[model samples]
Target: MPIKSIKKARKLIREKRKCVNASQWFCQISLAFFLAAILTNQLAYAFFDIAFLGELSTALQQAKVVWNVLMYFIPGLLMILAATALVMAGINGVVAFCYKQQLASLKRGEG
Candidate 1:
């Protein structure tokens, strides 16, 4: 093919959106994990003051059901977010791979 023809060829391959989105998903997951750790650590210290902690400790110890449910809920939400991000990254990766293949075929004049 002529240089002009190649330059004018409009392949459907995404330039950056798919790769960028895939990386963003991974970045979101990483940020979520980091924030979760920081918040959990800060909450632990804040909840451990000798005077103020006593009340919550007593309540939590007495009310096992609520404490257990709350304990599970936060982690459950984080896990859900992580799972969703991972699925999105997978989808973007698949799309980018297909796009790459199509572009490669076009390069060889096979498309």
Candidate 2:
């Protein structure tokens, strides 16, 4: 019985670690996407300042238009994705904390 209890505690500890790792990864992904979105937004504004409206070739002007749309649109999409990852990370963090508390109680033989 003691061996089985020890095994169960170890399993819980492993699960807790996995949850922590997953939460960390999700947070990192969220931060990266957020930074990328900010960068793209800044780039879009920088390109918007180009003063070659009347001097550029038709193809170049068309390319600029496409670039503007993509830059604007991509930031909004990425922000949404970042929010989702952040939410997932929060959930995982909560679960990991809960597991930690459970493990503590189990260790005290009061679980």
lDDT of 1 by residue, 79-109 (tens): 6666677777777777777767766777788
Model 1, C-alpha of 85: deviation from truth (Å): 0.5
Model 1 segments more than 4 A misplaced: 1-16, 30-64
What's the CA error at residue 32 for candidate 2, in Å?
A: 0.4
Reference-based lDDT, residue 96, model 1: 71
TM-score of model 2 (CA atoms):
0.81
What lDDT does the true structure give each of the candidates? Answer: 0.62, 0.88
Estimate the overall C-alpha local distance difference test score of candidate 1: 0.62
